[model samples]
Target: MKIFIIGITGRVGSLLARSLQDRGDTVSGLVRRPDQQSALQDAGIVAAVGDLTALTPEGLAELTGDVDALVFTAGAGGGTAEQTTAIDFGGVVTAIAAADLRGIRRFGLVSAFPEAWRERHLGAGFEHYMDMKKHADQALTHSDLDWIILRPAVLLDEAGTGRIALGPAELHGDVPRQDVADTMAELLHEPQITRQILELNHGGTPVAEAVQAAVRR
Candidate 1:
């Protein structure tokens, strides 16, 4: 399987690239800076550099040609509402349009847990971030493609516990970045996981088993 990953230099993206590559999949990553090339290269992933927010029709045509699946993990971290919308929401729209043009229907997204979007009623001051993520997730929901949205909780840098828990919007909790990456890689190979938005967290169990349980749900 050949995979095209956006934001491949990101924490989760880097891990996903390596995980896929190790499992014998050919991986290509979309990077924003030439300096990020080495990181992708180090992970044995081919790098294509461009700004997701600025992708033109022709640019998308050139980049997505021959790719099998696209995983969008790009984001504008800790930015103002406008900036967040530009990179997160607008970026997703751009990628979806580009993918459609190239007829690449398989897509995966790394989304935030819905709780992050809650306002004063649930939580406060994260409305902007939550709205940005919500908009992006909703856009993907209506896209003409096979897609799965994985919304994980507060991402931790701790070494992957290799455990994962998955449920509908009903489930909530934090998950390690590494496990999130692993789950994304696994979902890429499973067509049945399409058109679903799954919330993920640490299951205190093995990663593979947790994923299998999610699949069974």
Candidate 2:
């Protein structure tokens, strides 16, 4: 399978790209700067250098390079408020349009748990972040493409356990970034997983097993 990813340089994004590549899938990503191209090229991945904020749906679609699917993991990353909304929310909108324009039918989104605002409020900035994620997820959910929205709990950089609870279970505990990447890699490659919004957390079930279980659900 050939796949294109947004934010392929990020922690979870890089892991997902590696997992897909290890499985012999072609992976490509959009890099905003020319200097970032070398890293992806070093890894044997295709790099389409462009800023998400500036790309029209038509232009972005052209960069997809006739790939099979798109996974979006880009975030504001503590940028200014406007940048937060533009990247987090606006990027998804552009991606959706790009997918539609290109006739790409599958998409996966990396989002936060719904209880984010309720759990704690850092400030208006956080509230805005949650709002963007919420709307982005919603936008994809309502789009024509087959979509899987993975809402993971607190993200941990710790090594993956290869286990997770992936479903509508009550959200609890932190999940290693690797586990999330593994789960998403499977979901993107497997057609049987179906379309749904799954909540993820560290758990006893193996990552692949959890995904298979989601199909059974």
Best by TM-score: 2
| lDDT, candidate 1, 78-180, per-residue tens | 7666778888888888888888888888999999997743433633326777888899999999988888899998788878887777767545656789999
TM-scores of the candidates are: 0.91, 0.96
lDDT of 2 at 208: 78
> What local distance difference test score does each model get?
0.81, 0.89
Query: After TM-score superposition, what is the CA distance of residue 170 in candidate 1 from its true location, in Å?
Result: 4.6
Position 39, candidate 1: lDDT: 69
Model 1 weakest 10-residue run by lDDT = 116-125
Clashing pairs in 1: none
Q: Indicate the TM-score of model 2.
A: 0.96
In model 1, the runs with Cα more than 4 Å from the true position are: 117-125
lDDT of 2 at 10: 89
